[model samples]
Target: MDANRTLALFERLVEIESPSWHEAEMARACEAELQDLGFTVTFDGSAEQTGSDVGNLIAHRSGNADGAVAFSAHMDTVKPCAGICVMRVEDERGEVLCSGGDTILSADDKAGVTAIFEGIRSMLEAGGPLPDVWVILTTCEEQSLLGSGALKAADVPQGVDCFVLDADGAPGSVVCNAPCHHTMDVAICGKSAHAGVEPEAGVSAIQVAARAIADMQLGRLDGATTANVGVIEGGVATNIVADACSFQAECRSLFPERADEAKRQMTDAVTRACERAGAHADISWTLDYPEVACAEEDAIVRRAKRAIEACGLSFQAVRTGGGADANCLRGLGVNAITLGTGMANFHATTEYIKVQDLLDDARLVEALIAEYAGS
Candidate 1:
């Protein structure tokens, strides 16, 4: 496979704007590219459900008669409107680096998408033996996995296996464990009264919220868990005792019980604070996505480790508190793991991926396919 060709494709994909629920043009581009690669592609109804102009793209490439293996990634980014202008560079050690400017280079998942595309291209060019390959490019992954959530598990091809190439850190690092997240909104309602004249008659919802927040345990809660109240808004005027306040919070943990425990604590704190202040508290919580924890010795994980090592990189399985498309693929009952594309500083303007690392990831993908075909 030509490294330059793959790098070019990665740059092109990152430059495209495909943020959250706005993935129309990017989805179309993926569809066109998949079709050009001689794959039969289908567009699901996730767009309408997700409020996007385009839906998820599912493509199938039939080769050897072996069971199908799918490679997946999301087609979106959390952004500052940065257009991909990838620059290829090498340091003294001859490591590949791909970057643009002050904006994000979008190696996050774009590199993953490009790698999968190039892998397919290489197989087609080589001709002869190859396993059945399926491609799933999802939308609205950044908006809490809405696209994957809307997708029907039964719609995925039969006898399907999957690899979601959308993670960070070293190339060999395979994320076998990730956390489930609970997104919540807490509202506190209290009776309003004149602050200067009848302060005692009024209950302060803001005070209730303050007490709850003070009592809540946020940030790091052991190595595998965390909780935080990110946004708070309440009250109308300072002169009057505020009658309403609300806060948005979330808890994430690798273990289901840990997340549930955190939510329970949050609920207790909010209820106690409200009751003490003679106010009503309303709590609404939603499990944004499920966790995925694959054993280190699992066959798929072992195969991926071997593939990475074959490509001249170290292989290791890891656990992460972050969620990804991998979690959603696992939800589909695919034995999947998240692979890094060397994306750095994700969800920030400084995000970048070494051009050489991008090439390495592409080679890693090829190695994975080759291993599967041989097996």
Candidate 2:
């Protein structure tokens, strides 16, 4: 592959601002690029559901060999990514790509996108036997895998194993386990009263919420489970007793039952606090995404290991506390595993990836295609 050409593609993609729920420009660019590569690209009808300007881009190309493989990457980036300026710096560690320090480089998935695109270009130039390939570029992935969750199974071709190129680590690292996530919104209601005159008449919802939070065992519940109360909002003024309070919390665990148990315990804590404070509590819990665990011996994982080794990288299986598009794809019955894109400090202003890592990722992609093609 042409290193300069690949770097140019990465720079162009990072230059485009594609925050969650607003990825039309990036989607259009990807569509045009795939079309230029002789792939049949189409958009799914998930825009309305995902509330994105455009649906997921699903592109397909026939191959000269048997076996079908699918690759996935999200088009959305976290906030504060606007006005991004990519800079290439050479140091003792070799070439590294970074933003201007005022904004994120958006290399989280753009690096993945660059690798996939350049890998395909290399394959085409070599004119070697290849497997049938499908590329799915999704939007709103920064928002709890919204894009991939909204994707319809019918839109994806059958009998195709999926590979998600959106993990944070070295290029050879594979995310084989991710936790199930559940979000909870709790509202505590109580009567208001004058703080100075008749403070005794009011049931302080703030106190109730504080009590509930104190009673709950939050943060690092166990080896695989964790709970956190991230947001809290309530009360009108300090003069009057607090009437209502609301908080948003989340629980995550590698096992679904553990996550559910954590939710139940938190709910019970809220109930006990409300009962003691004579306040009414309203708690709602929703499962954001299910946990995904792919065995190292699985066919897709084996292929990934082989491909990584072929690129002279050590294959390391990892478990993540975060979620990605792979979670939704696995939920949808696609055999999927997430591969690292050599991103470091992602979602931060200091995010960067080594240029050599980018080239190695592209080579890994090519190796994967060849492995699937039975070459």
Best by lDDT: 2
> What are the clash counts of all predictions, listed in order?
8, 0
Q: Candidate 2 on 107-150: residue-level lDDT in tens?
A: 89999998999998898889988888899999999887889989
lDDT per residue, candidate 1, 193-246, as tens digits?
999999999999999999999999999998999999999998888899999999
Clashes of 2: 0
Give each model a TM-score. 0.87, 0.87
**Prediction 2 TM-score vs. true:** 0.87
The CA-based lDDT of model 1 is what? Answer: 0.82
Once superposed on the true structure, which residue ranges of model 2 sit more than 4 Å away at CA?
A: 49-51, 79-85, 100-103, 157-159, 191-204, 237-243
Error of 1 at 72 (Å): 1.3
